[model samples]
Every structure is written in structure tokens, then in C-alpha cells.
Target: MKIHNSRLISALFAIAFGAMQTVSAAAETVRSLDDLAFLEGHWRGGEDFVFEETWNGAEGGVMTGMARGVSSGELKVLEYIVVSAEEDAVVMRFKHFRRDFSTWEDGGPIILMLTDAKENDVTFSADPPSETVKSIRYFKTGENTLQADIVLVEDGEEGGFTLVFDRAD
Candidate 1:
């Protein structure tokens, strides 16, 4: 009886561990910027403010882009962004600037390394980690619409906004 019980317990543990490993493996698929080529174009939209972003097509393992936000006919914020392939991971970096071209990040650009990805959705996290902002995710909803979600990881808080861009070419 003791031998039977021990065998049963070990079998259950093995099954449970295997299930966990399967889930983890599915959640860590690597993605490339070429999979996100649909994002290449001039996109503009905002609810209370006007926002615009222009992205060049992926080439040579890198994509370059710029974003701007305006309110009441006044420039509010600007960002220079880049996405590049680094070894086996995709990396995103952004630097914020004011209307006068003054940088917002005194230390340097914010870096986000790819964590998970699928057909139209990809997630990235700050490489060295941050208290205020931790992750950013982009999901394509339609042929020309994209949604961006920014995660504030300190307390697990999240906030996001959507942008729709028409093909400018």
C-alpha cells in the first residue's frame, strides 16, 4: 500500500510540473520587427489632444520613428523612437523632448526589451527596470489601427490610449 501511494504522488507532481512548463514556454515566444511591418506609415489620432507618429519601414534590422503630441495648438511633447534587433531579442528605445527640444530623460533614453509576442501583439519591458514605467505593449486592431498600452509596474497599475493612422503614402 505504501509503495502504491508513493508512486501516485510522484506521478501527480510530474504532471503538474509539466503543465506549468508548457504554459511558460507558450508565453515567451520571441518576435521580430519584420512581423510588425504593418506599423510603417504616418499615423495620427487623439481624443482630447492631437497626436501623430511616423515610422519608417523596417530595414537592416532596425526601424526609426517619431511621435508628437499637441494640445490647443501648442506642442506638448515629442518622442524619438527606434526599434532594433539585438541578438535574439527585439529592443525599443525612446527619448522624450519638449517643444524647445529639451530632453525629458536626464539619464538617457528609456529602453524596453521584448518579452512576448504574437501575430499582431508584442510586449516589451524596461531593460534595467523602472519604478514608474515598466512595460509597453502594441496591438494591431485592424489593417490600419494600432493600440498602445503602457504599464506602470510599480504598483501594477496600467493606462493606455489608442491611435488610428491612415496610410500617408
Candidate 2:
């Protein structure tokens, strides 16, 4: 009788574990749009990047165009980023898009944490094993401008530049 009771207790414990996992996952579901609704306008900015190397001439430059949020399935702004083109498997995603059929996938960065509304900021770690490049993007609202600042961190240390933007209008 003791052996039978022990087996019954084990079965009950397994069932409880499965139920707890489901509840935890639902808690992590989309609670509100507070996470991504801040970035919703046109912005213009100049982007510049520098590289370190043993050789004398191996840096890069770009003319940046930026566009923010969308509605009714459209590209609403002119802002831009050339990051994914140079790197492999880097992608972007919004809450609306689906992974099974969307070309712009959510593979770029994890939205690690968020601040209050009307502020745009993100922490991104690109290619976890590669300590060569990782960064944070911080954007904020202004009187007559909308701004985004990009700061890169390498191997747990912070380096790179900040980009301040003006409203494109």
C-alpha cells in the first residue's frame, strides 16, 4: 500500500508542475502597448561609426534615415538603419507581426527592460557568444525634435558613440 501511495504522489507533483508553467507563461503575455507605443514619428539624423584595428584604414560611414511606428500596414517614416544588411540573421519585429510568415523577424534584440511611456530605449546583445559587438539604443522626446542615441558595449564594457536626432519635418 505504501508503494502505491508513493506513485500517486509523484503523479500529482508532475501535474502541478505543468500547471505552474502554464500560469507563468500567461503572466508574461502582452499586458499593454506601453512597451512600444512611444516611437511614432519621423526623424532625421547623421550616423557615424569608427572601428579599431591594427591596420591604418578600416572604418566606415553612413548617411542615416529614420522612420518610426506604423499603422494600417505601412512604412510611416523615413528613418533607417543599415545594421541588419551588414550582419547575418539580424532582424526586426513589432507586436503585430507573426513569426511563421513575417520576413522581419524578432531576432535582433531582446526588449530586456522598459521605462515610462513616451521614452524609447532598448538593450541589445547581438550574437551572444561573439563579444565583438553589442549595444543599447535610447530615444527620448523633445520640444521640437525626437532623438535616438546608440551606445555600443563590447564584452561587458561600454564603448561607441551617441546619435542625437532632430524631427525631420
Q: Rate the local accuracy (lDDT) of all candidates.
A: 0.80, 0.40
lDDT of 2 by residue, 10-92 (tens): 99999999999998876564223333333444444543321110111112421122334333444433223322212222232
Give the clashing residue pairs of candidate 1, or none: none
* Count of clashes, each model: 0, 6
Compared with the true structure, the alpha-carbon lDDT of candidate 2 equals: 0.40
* lDDT value for model 1: 0.80
In model 1, which runs have C-alpha deviations exceeding 4 angstroms?
1-28, 153-169
Tell me each candidate's TM-score: 0.73, 0.39
Q: For model 2, name the residue pairs that clash.
A: 65-79, 65-80, 66-78, 66-79, 66-80, 67-79
Q: Pick the candidate with the highest TM-score.
A: 1
